[model samples]
Target: MSTPRNVQQLFDLTGRVALVTGGSRGLGLQMAMALGEAGAKVVISSRKAADLEQAVMTLQDAGIDARWVAADASKPEDINRMVDETMERLGHIDILVNNAGATWGAAAEEYPLEAWDKVMNLNVRGYFLLSQAVAQRSMIPRKQGRIINVASIAGLGGNHPMMRTIAYNTSKGAVINFTRALACEWGHKGIRVNAIAPGFFPSKMTAGTLAAVGEEQMAAHAPLLRLGDDEDLKGATLLFASEAGKHITGQILAVDGGVSAVTGG
Candidate 1:
């Protein structure tokens, strides 16, 4: 057998390519930055060109090799086009981060069908299509890949009484199982699938939730007694995207500062 690689070498992502969806902001951009910082060339995608442009500049300012594509993850045509464009530009994708998602607030008994469909389509179905496209177009042939799906601690169980995001919570639960099932099917193809179940982090998507639930109250739910900062996800993202996690698959890692452990949440 060959000697083991050193920690730094194992974590290095040089020469690899990554595609991150919903990457213009929030948790998605955080993960993109982590991958690029570790030496992978990264392509960030979202529906709006303006947002992608700004995000690309931010990544570039940090001295990362970054590019952007504009596409709505919920649309199949867009998913195909995004993957094709990424492949055309970078030649291959070694990592795919399924981070685009949507959430709707409503009491379960009063939820609108349109709202439910919107959340599920973007959060769950989008992940499936994009992963399938990337795998078929790149990873399966190469026989090696890393897929990091951004799930949520909400998937662990129900949310606080003040929260009312039935569709979002359900979609996340699906994502958790989707990660596991895909890992099982793709392991033989040398693809490792895992998920990062983040708790409450302040972002555009969570702004309303934070206000509704009260940031301090939300933080108090976690043993760490703090909401996640910009840097909280970097280490976990790097671990899953790098060779350091080569043997890990079908796992759901909670980056929630012990919230899930304490509250199943």
Candidate 2:
């Protein structure tokens, strides 16, 4: 493929097809909007059909060619079905966003084994399963693809004691390396893999933590002195998904408002 000479061409996602897991709401929805607005046909997935219906409607309202499938990222059968459905409906997948995940909060000493396994299964294993399926079925044969995994700033190191999410933190730490390792293995085949380690973002997963640690206190840790706004991730997501990041691979880009930089991420 030849390179596009203009800036708009570099950032454009025209004619691409993207699949985003957990795309019904929160950061997943935000990134889906970015991809759709840039002209990619978008497919979003979540465990709930009702949520998927609502999300599809929202995207349609915004004039995006978006739709959804109901699949549990944690299950292998469900993951395969998602890929099958995407192929049947969209024909091919050019970009895959592994954004589906779970978080568990409990003191390290009291964390339940079941909860730990659940978080690990969904956050780490689930990502690998889905990414592998997409690559094998779509990217590898075509020799072109982009995979974006959503890690967390907590993965860079230990979190505040108040966070108390050992399993979630550990899984994200693994995700950082998973991005690097996959990029190394797939780059030769024209696949680019990378991760975004976001700082505190307002979502259902973080609501409890934010409530306990207040928004103002959370913002104070970052030099920017503010929590992530709705549009904060759009630019970074576009960079990775579009030709703007064609040379980049196997890197973890933190969109944490300088919190990771100050905290040694």
Full-model lDDT for every candidate: 0.94, 0.95
Q: Write the per-residue lDDT of candidate 2 for residues 1-265, one digit (tens) a residue.
A: 8654798889999899999999999999999999999999999999999998998899999999998999999999999999999999988999999999999889999999999999999999999999999999999999999999999999998988789999999999999999999999999999999999999988999999999999999999999998897899999899999999999999999988899889897
Worst 10 residues of 2 by lDDT: 1-10
Please write out the lDDT profile of model 1 over residues 1-265, one tens digit for every residue.
9898999999999999999999999899999999999999999999999999999999999989999999999999999999999999999999999999999888999999999999999999999999999999999999999999999998989877878999999999999999999999999999999999999999998998899889999898789999998899999998999999999999999999898988745
Q: What is the C-alpha RMSD of each candidate to the true structure, in Å?
A: 0.8, 1.1
Number of clashing residue pairs in every model?
0, 0
Candidate 1's C-alpha runs over 4 A off are none
For model 2, the superposed segments whose C-alpha errors exceed 4 Å read 1-4
